[model samples]
Target: MKDFITPDTGTQIGTLALQNPIMPASGTFSEDLADVFDLDVLGAHVLKTIMHGMRAGNPTPRVCDMPSGMMNAIGIPSKGIDDFRDRMLPYWAGYGAPLVVSISAHSMDEFVRLCEAVSLPGVAAIEANISCPNIEADGRAFAMRPDTTHTVIERLRGCTDLPLWAKLSPNTGEPAEVGRAAQDAGADALVVANTMLGMSIDVASRTPRLGNVMGGMSGPAIKPVALRMTYQCARACHIPVIGCGGISTLEDVLEFLIAGARAVQIGTATFQSPTIMARLVTQLRDWMAAQGVSSLGEIIGTLEIPQAADGVWA
Candidate 1:
């Protein structure tokens, strides 16, 4: 048996590099997982998205069931950046999965302030929570519009020296255009996708299932949408892409990578099995060995899409 999961499968996203590219999206796997799985084994860890202030978030009945997945109107509830630094940061440092702090801000100042605060020495990097940009005012996810994404990143980009991974949203006009805007606005890397905006209805009750009328749909349901965005954005932007949405098994991870994702995020799968990440990581290592591949990079974005040259994979 050889050391299949070596540093070569390891790759860099800005200044942060990991043994592999399997990371948990913010909010999917909270810090509470230490009770179940050893956080130290993960390739990278992305903290839950926190904001400038503690948020109560939507109403009751925040989650609901959909066809192949679930929907959540989890409006970014957290203990605020200060509280996170005081209570969570210490614990985050202990786990040490290349700490990537995620923060959401409504106004530009709020995002910059949050970024500066989290730029503390212990944090390896930061992932801008630009996913649901509509939290403040708009009718869509905030990052859904290119201008909003660009402005948010531009304001927060210089707040700290740490690398910024702007998580892109599938709720945009053209996924590729927003990907380009993120790169142009100085994103160190792009996390291709948050959940798709959707609502589930209970026909008998004649109302939405979630507390809020709309919820962010995740899990197997959104996998194909995420794949399309990842493939498209990878070609359009020069920055690296960390794919998310419905990644459940070793095969799913491979699909995203072969389609040109530098790394992939496991979302809804974690909810089903908290320890699934550990198994997936182990499986990926075994798969790599069987394929005679010594490194993960060799397989990243290797798909032979003709449109890759144009920054839009078919």
Candidate 2:
């Protein structure tokens, strides 16, 4: 019998290295998914955002389906740090993939506290969900502005030695500036983007589709926005950028990598196909081999467009 070799999909974000580039976006991932397939299949386990105290989340109708995607205002309901540490930590620690815990807070003090607490031994990295409202800033998200993004990342960086991944929001108009601020503040990587803030209306019912009136839109519909941000941040910052949007197939994964994302996160698409991530892992390896690619790094940030006569991209 002969041994077969698989192409390498491993990538590094800061000092942390992942076996593959596929992971579930926060809020869409959980231990329950382990039942569908092995957790080791993922590059890393990115847990949902955890708060200092429990959150009840938004009102009813937190989720609504759109024509091409979906909107969610689930509000990041959490059982708080204590429950997560005592209950979920042990189970996650059993997995081979690294655990990247996502944390959210309304104040700088709370963010610092959560960052310090989650930096325990065995954790691989910390992903700060800066899209949450900053109570001190009158409810504006920290990632909405360059200054706020710097303040949040700088403070959190000081609290932990673990690799810091500043998860930015797609709702912002200046994602490049935000990415630069995060890098200057010591972020090892950027997860370029949370979700786009959007709303849907029902004509016959004459009311908003979501109970929150507005929610974060995600799926194939938002891939273009996410891809654009990934390209901008990847070029504007030195740190790695992890693209998250509507990735469902090998092509989507390759597109993000080509656009400069060192890694990609699969979200809503997973809800429709539980084993999609596992399938993607195999598909990526096969595609690379078929294309005579030895490593994913070879194809990353390699997009090409012809220049026009006026010196602009055609």
> Cα lDDT for residue 49, model 1?
89
Where does model 2 exceed 4 Å of error? 1-5, 309-314
- What's the lDDT of the predicted structure labeled candidate 2? 0.92
Query: What clash count goes with each model?
Result: 6, 0
What's model 1's overall lDDT? 0.84
TM-score, cand. 2 vs. native: 0.96
lDDT of 2 by residue, 179-288 (tens): 99999999999998898899988999999989889899999999999999999999999899999998998999999999999999999998999999999999999988
* Per-residue lDDT over 1-314 for candidate 1, one digit per residue giving the tens place of the 0 to 100 score: 75454435687787777878888988887777788878887889888888888789889689988888999998888788779888888987887588888888776777888899889978888899887554455545558778887888888787877898999887876889888888899999999888888988899999888888988989998999999899899889888899999999898999999888988888889999989988888898877777778888789888875664775446
lDDT of each: 0.84, 0.92
Question: Which 10-residue window of candidate 2 scores lowest in summed lDDT?
Answer: 305-314
Question: Residue 57 in candidate 1 has what lDDT?
Answer: 89
